[model samples]
Target: MKSLLSLLLASLLSVFSLPGLAQTPEAQSLLASVLALKPNAERGEAEFVAQACSACHRKDGSGKSAGNTPRLSGQHGAVIIKQVLDIRSGLRHNPPMQPRVTEQSLSLQTLADIAAHLQALPISGTIAKGPGSGVARGKELFAKDCAGCHGANGQGNQATFVPMVAAQHYGYSLRELEFIRDGKRGNSNRAMASLIKTYDQDDLLALADYMAQLPAPQRK
Candidate 1:
């Protein structure tokens, strides 16, 4: 009984502690600088290759579904910038991405350019999807809980720095959603964390599947 109580207390502490871990001042400043610069997609294309980002994310930023990489094509530049900055600042934990995105590795201009290039890439190819059984429940949950922030079609808002979830890889989405729900993702939005805190594994599965099946937003 004592061990059980201790474990429960530790769990609560972990959850509460995560809220303070994200968005360092340095990260925010860097994000602002990156966002202010005019991105050169042409330069970005070259940089992306030079940086070996294509090795995992692919040349087109479609990401590797089997590798559990989130699709970056057509995602908002602001969203991408913020995530990169967060990872660099250690506000977000991505072991594989950490060394590659260090300050010495990516200049503000290069980061901006990379973001632009990825955002402009068209989402294509076969995205990994979940089992069809949960899609209906997922759709219903998204409409009720996620549509307001992520848009009805899951086309995330650029100005708000929300990511486009339409057609994202199912495995990646589910993994991230689970991380967010469990307070394991340090950079998670507070409101989003709160909203999903009570969600179970089944709920997360449905949500990921529904988002995965949504059509990719048409880029202008």
Candidate 2:
């Protein structure tokens, strides 16, 4: 009975301790910098472009239109690194992204190396726009559902883990909404999940269209 009880206690302790094992952006960054194990920019660049990351996000970090993937240009390196880790940890849901991030290895060094390379890319100036019957409907949905944390303008609060959406590539923005709806993105973002849960397919599309017309976010 004592042995069985001890085993049960150990199982409970492991379950409770998993969160502490999650990699932090700071941890990944420090390790990459200190160990000099970050993949060279050249290697990372090749890997990024050659790998499927470029397909949805664009080669110049401009972003795609069909996939609703976002512009990856000029994102904070730490934030970028953490996102990949979050997806793997199921803190964010992304079955598609999970495979890629964990494909080679889900180590912190690999995440940091990819982030470093992406951060160095030149920004694309292609702003998004939308015009259609659904624009007004999309705007209404944004006002009612999305504007609180993402701002009325879709400029997100990074501190809140709310990503900027104003002038984000329509494809990328739509993708984000889809992920939220499917419970594949923003696992840690209660507000986002709640907002998305109330959204239908048309609502998601409209939100994407409306956000496409907003002004670009100011980078730090």
- Top candidate on TM-score is 1
How far out, in Å, is residue 66 in model 1? 2.0
Listed in order, each prediction's TM-score against the native is 0.88, 0.63
The residue-by-residue lDDT of candidate 2 on 1-220, one tens digit each, is 4442244334333422345333455544443342334446666667676666888777777776555466777554544755675676566767777787773654556555566677666656675655455679998988887787578877664333345667776767777778767766654455456657877888878877888777665555
Question: For model 1, how does the per-residue alpha-carbon lDDT over 48-162 read when each residue is reduced to its tens digit?
Answer: 9999998888887888888368889888877888888888887778988989999898898999899889888889777898987899999988999999989999998775567
Positional deviation of 79 in candidate 2, in angstroms?
3.8
* Clash totals in order: 0, 6
For candidate 2, the per-residue lDDT at 123 reads 57
Candidate 2 residues lying further than 4 Å off, grouped into runs, are 1-52, 103-107, 116-122, 125-130, 184-188
Residue 88: error of model 2 in Å?
Answer: 1.9
The 10-residue segment with the lowest total lDDT in model 1: 4-13
What shift in Å separates residue 203 of candidate 1 from its native position after superposition?
0.7
